[model samples]
Target: MSPATAVVLCALAWTVFLGAHLALNGRWWPWLAVSLLPPPLFAAAPLALLLAAAASGSVPGAVLAAGCLLAGWRQSGVNSRAVRRSSPERAGIRVVSWNTQHWNQGREPDRFYAFLHSLPADIYLLQEYLNGFEGGEVWDIDDEERLRREFPGHHLSVDNNSVTLSRFPPAGPPVPVGACSLRVDVRTPDGILSTYNVHIPVQLTVMNPLSRAFFQDMRRRHGARRREYDALVADLLANPHPFLVSGDFNTSAAIGDIRRMPRAAHDAIGANRSLFPASWHARWRLRLWRIDWVFTSAGVRAEQYTFRDPGGLSDHLAQDVTITTTAIEEMNR
Candidate 1:
């Protein structure tokens, strides 16, 4: 094929991607697809260069490249100022949330133990941590006993897929909110701090092959997740203390409902950091996406945020957010 023909083909493909990016961020329902397949927009620069090289006066290609550039910047969170390395005073609380990929036995126990020891978070919220407990809906006592003996003084979900490990003991037993959400308040210097760690079901897949069943599945999953979001938010909001709702939402911030946190909570990473931190890997560190999140109340300010090793043990990346509520207390003082 001629270089011009190749450039023409690349330009067409780039145009389609550019259009998809623009359409995906729209408030309309179709934009939901963008939330799932966000990484494709990154191809804009290379394609634009190819187009420009093949044809010096390629107006359509130029426009497509420009749009792609704009979208890429926004998606990359270039303007995000939410993440930092350390807290303003280093006295803020550090919270870590990771989907530990079921903490499969013997998968990466040595590394996992090292991670647990090295994590600086005062509070740890882990999802998909399993202990091989499966028998007639009964939690395996052996598994539960092992974790209790190893990591005692924490409220854990044996049946569900989430766990909350705090430096301080829970004020009381964990209160069940719903399917995979539990609330546990801890005593802090400022006051009581409540955390609702949830594991929501996965959202509609955009990468799936396009078919009638795809649309139906998307709608079904979206509807179910929407209800769960509403319910989880309501339950968390009704509780006492300045709270944070965190864990894997399985939905990207590109979705309206996903962006709408319970009680107007702020996304610690999204608000403070401007860089796109994809938190999940599909196959062998490929197909990355940010489905895990941490949301804090207005009173709690996230001073810093960072992602754990992407290619680490779990398919999901760990989210470490160092936050301070001292600002609120200081203001009150």
Candidate 2:
């Protein structure tokens, strides 16, 4: 094929690929298209297309590459090349949200727990945080008696699939509602901090099954998750305290309007306008999707946002967030 023709095909291919991510969800044919394209192909196809086209001496290749890069950069949301760092302007409260995938005491227990202890976070809220309290005893890190020895005096609540470990006491116990959400209010020196930790499972077992039943189930899961998000937003609105909602959203942040994530809250990750740090796997261990998220309400803003490397145990990368009191007067109240 002529270089010109090849470049044109390449541009069209990249355009279609980008369009698919923006438009498709777990429905029918589009679902297949979106899911079938593996994460590697999703990330690399456009780059490959651009390079092959540029080598072909086709001017269109440059234009297509520019468009492709621009689109990607926008989706990435990163403004500056340098990652933002913690600042004193922030309220001196460091919060880390992680979906530990229940591996705080797995193969690398020492490393995991050590890393956990090292974070300077005043609070650590986790999803998929499991520590059974069956025998009239509360346990963390696999119920080791040492937990009491190690954490001493630090407040911890590990109930439901969601957990919160903080320096100060939360106003009450976690409120679990809908299918997979936990709400809590932390009484910080600044004010009451309303926080919600949500986990929206993607129904992986039925997502790709050939049976029509599974296909229908996939759609229902989407509908159900949508409702859960709506209800969570409503709850966040009713909260009297300064608030933030962080979670394993399951769906991509690029689908913002569909998720209808709170307009009043600033999506901390997006608000930082930082680089795309994939929170989920693409292959044996490749990071590809930034599904884990953090959002803060009007009076609060993130001073810095950073993530841990994907620990071998969990599919998610832990997010360390430093939030500031944008409205000092409100926080004083």
Candidate 3:
């Protein structure tokens, strides 16, 4: 093949791949195919194509590269600010959300307990409170006595695998929202704050994407994930109290699940200035996908939002958010 022909072919392939990332939406078979793929592909693939186009003097390749750049920017959720304001409002309540993989069951028990003690938060919305998975099955982890001893005065609420430890008083009992989330209401100084601690089902359990079984499992898991999103959205829509949803969603920013979240609530990470703010896969320290997130209702604003390293305690980074109620809402309450 001629050099020009080869360049054209490569550019066309890259364009199709990049376009797929931008065009696909919702929990469906088409989206499932590329959902688990890393965000880094969005960056690297386009840059490589742009360089090839520059070397070959291909206008069409350059145009495609521009499209890819736009796709990357949109998919990465980059905001205008370089970084959000670091100083948290004194009146805001600080919340620390993390998916501690079978809390304190892993290698360093001392470090894990110490790290939990160190986070400066009034409320802790923690997921994966179970013991680590054994033989593809989950085992319970009962740390109630120990947690009471450690946290001292905090109110503890446990629903299935999710847990919420709060310094405030409990406004109501824990409510399970489907199998993906645990809803707990706490009466803070401002008013009642409804919090949902979520851990959505992981996508594509049957790993090998090339096989028929993989596609079948993908379809099943996608449907399950969609149901979880719908259930939570429905609950949020009907909720009267100002709410905060925080946990390991197991869904990335690039996918449709994030879009399925209620429009009434604002993404806490939206305030982040960095283009690629990742929270999962801390082992490699690549921080490629941000599967964990925190969202707040209209009246509740995030004064400060950030992702902190788990310090080798878990595979996911910790999300620390300081949220405060609007004055109008506080007065009405």
Candidate 4:
């Protein structure tokens, strides 16, 4: 092949590879209109081969190759920490925080119960636990009861829309912080670990049909949501205890306000720089938003944070965190 022809083919391949990355993420509108081409351009084998060859030898080429590989890896559904099990420690804790959409949404109550049962966690922090839905009627009391029955050894506390399924009993009632946040001291084998389960009101930008309509007045509603979040964090900082704060914060990990939370409030997900992009998403798949998070105070140490793919069940994936109080004490010392 001619030198000029090879260069052109290489460039075309790189463009297709990048386009596929963006398109799979639902981020190909302007390019789509400009090119007047379908998404199959990204999946073409010739383009993949050209990009791989072009990315050889040079640093920039290597980086480009890595990017293409990573993008393809995510799309292939094989690149995740699914089989990686949490290490068992003599004196540590395993906590799993998930929005769970609603326990009663897609799966039957029994199947949902089974799914929760399968997880090996000392504390399961759940957001969107449906006490009531649509009209003022109880939605998943039976499922809640099943959880209590299945985990008879643990204490179950439901505050507003959040729920805590704990292996130890709570020291007091679940402390409510505004309409969405809650704090409670659970008695663990090691000590009384205060666990905060928060479901910050979904930002106005991502609110569903009903919430979108309710918060149609953007400035007022968004301001209220921000204020509510500020107040909740303030309250948490004031609370006395080595705590684990978990739930769906409804903001991205890149937000300045969230980043400013006392360095003590470390995000486990941030530990793995490879998983989510440093830059947050703006829309679904274009996903600049990382509303769901798990933050820890000084008293806790996160051994590992795994962001598992949704497995097509919920819109957001599950954040599986294995933390130990030993890390917290060492940090304090």
Candidate 5:
């Protein structure tokens, strides 16, 4: 065979093999195929490649290396100016919402606690809190005590499922909207701030047949969980107060119903941020979804919002936000 022909054949064969490898496993080989994927797919591939390159150095890998460094900056645990002065008396109250994946049972609890320790929020809303009593056992008093110690001088309430810790005293009794929601008022320098900690039922339509069947049964038994969420939202809107609501609603902010909840009441993380990794295993990977949220009334304005990375503990990343409300009104000419 001619040398020119031999070189061309070898190049073609190598290209085909690399393409197949990427199609099968995306972590490394996919970087080569990135140019061939759809635009959006190609955009997100760089992040994966960056993470891979950071873990394993390679030539022509400087782009991924830089991306990894940039993404890591947001998760470095450095408190922003807003986060540092979040006290009610100084800066406006800061509220944070996070789904801790049963408080990081898959890893050490300290990792989760360390993340929480970095923030000085007046009110904290946490979802996926395990009570350890689902099997008809005693309550987890030790876990409760630890939380109390962590946030000293805060009014605390635990619903055996979700928990709310605050620096201000409770303004009213704990009002339960559902098994997953708790509403209360806490005092702030401006006045009382009404807040809700919610954890909505997860969407089951995307799981396996058996899992889907179980979720369907749950829906039938519960009689439309979305309606319950709607009712809670309606009640909050009707009430007159500076409202702040946060939790894992198990739905995206772009949904029609969610969007209708007054743009004033919007997630700090915005409607476009993806809180969960799109792929777990190769076959189970799917499109990005935003299930967690933090919303406020007209009086509050979100100054900054961020989605934290997995500190190697929970399945979902933590979302931290800083909000401000000014008494001045805008005038039209």
Candidate 6:
């Protein structure tokens, strides 16, 4: 192929790949199924294309490739490179958020429990508190007794599929949010904090993309995902106390759902420093997608944030965050 022709193909390839993530992104039908793939895969396509074109020594192709990358970067999700640390004297609450896929049933139960014991978090927001899928069918799991026995000091709040075990006593009973999420008002040393443990439904299951069933299921799942996001957004708006929300949102940095959150909401990961800090599909060393997140309202600040490897126990990494009150006015009633 001619060098010029090769460059054009490379640019077009990148354009289509970037367009999918920028435009489709699980927001619509058939294309929604395509979006299930990690967005980083799309974001990285331009880089690969750029290298191929540049190797051809085609200046225009290299320039066009660079432009595509810039566009991808602009639309890419938030990531922070700068580490924010708290003052030694400042008291911060350590919150650990994790989606224990099928709980301990899928892994060695003792090791799973031991991993949980190692985290020195004040509050634990856990999801997928259900039994492992058996031949594609999932059943409820009753681990409340075991959880209580394992973590003696914390109070447990169990909603549908998520659990909130807090060392801080409950200020009130757990509020009904939705089937995929749980909210609890807890009394903290700083003040009453509204904490949400969420597990938003995935957009689509892996299947034959060209099949009619795939699109149909994608549409149904999209609708369900929207309703869940709407419920969570509504609660976040009406909540009066300083809040923290953490979970498997089943959303990427590129999705509109996370953007639908309150304008004042701050990411627990702090300011955007890195481009892709993925937390799911742990087997992939690159960790292409960040489906799990930790977000806090205006009054709260995340002093430290980190994602812990689950040691093949689950598909997602655990989010460990240290949050402190930024303003007395916001935390106090």
Question: Runs in model 2 with CA error above 4 Å?
Answer: 26-91, 103-115, 131-152, 206-217, 252-259, 270-276, 281-286, 309-313, 327-333
How many backbone clashes does every candidate have? 7, 0, 0, 7, 0, 6
Worst 10 contiguous positions by lDDT, candidate 3:
324-333
Per-residue C-alpha lDDT of model 6 across residues 1-333, encoded as one tens digit per residue: 897678778787777777665676646555555555556554466777777776787777777788887776634553534444434534589899999988988578899989898897899999988885632678887888989999899999998788899999999999867668999999887788899998888877778978888778888888888888889888888888889999999888666567667775677665323446778887667676788988888778877777889888888999888888744555322
Q: In model 5, what is the error at residue 285, expressed in angstroms? A: 12
- Show the lowest summed lDDT stretch of 10 residues, model 4: 26-35
For each candidate, the alpha-carbon lDDT, in order, equals: 0.63, 0.64, 0.78, 0.59, 0.56, 0.78
Sort by TM-score, top down from the best: 3, 6, 2, 1, 4, 5
Query: What are the root-mean-square deviations of the candidates from the true structure over C-alphas?
Result: 5.7, 5.6, 3.2, 9.1, 11.9, 3.5
Which stretches of candidate 6 lie above 4 Å from their native place? 1-9, 16-21, 48-67, 74-91, 106-108, 271-276, 283-286, 330-333
Task: Write down the TM-score of every candidate.
Answer: 0.70, 0.72, 0.86, 0.62, 0.60, 0.84
lDDT of 3 by residue, 1-333 (tens): 765556667778877865665667564565865756665666666778778878888878777877777766545544435454555345678899999987878567678878888896789988888885632577887878887888887999998688799999999899999886899989877788899998888876645668888778878878888888888988888888889999988877666678888778778776555657778788774667788988988778887778888888888988988888763353122
Give a tens-digit lDDT track for model 5, residues 144-195: 7788777887788777367788888888877776667888877666676778
Give the Cα-based TM-score of candidate 2 against the true structure.
0.72
Q: Model 5 compared with the native: what TM-score? A: 0.60
How do the residues 149-241 of candidate 1 rate in per-residue lDDT, one tens digit apiece? 656655454435567778766777777666666677877667777887777766555555478867776666666676677778777566546
Give the C-alpha lDDT of model 1: 0.63
Runs of candidate 1 exceeding 4 Å displacement = 1-34, 39-79, 82-89, 105-111, 131-142, 153-159, 204-213, 270-274, 282-287, 310-312, 327-333
Question: Residues 291-327, candidate 2, lDDT per residue (tens digit)?
Answer: 7788887677787777776447566778888876643
Q: Which candidate model has the greater TM-score, 2 or 4?
A: 2
Top TM-score hit = 3
Badly placed stretches (over 4 Å) of model 4 are: 1-91, 131-142, 205-216, 257-260, 270-273, 277-289, 327-333
Give the Å error, residue 52, model 1.
Answer: 7.1
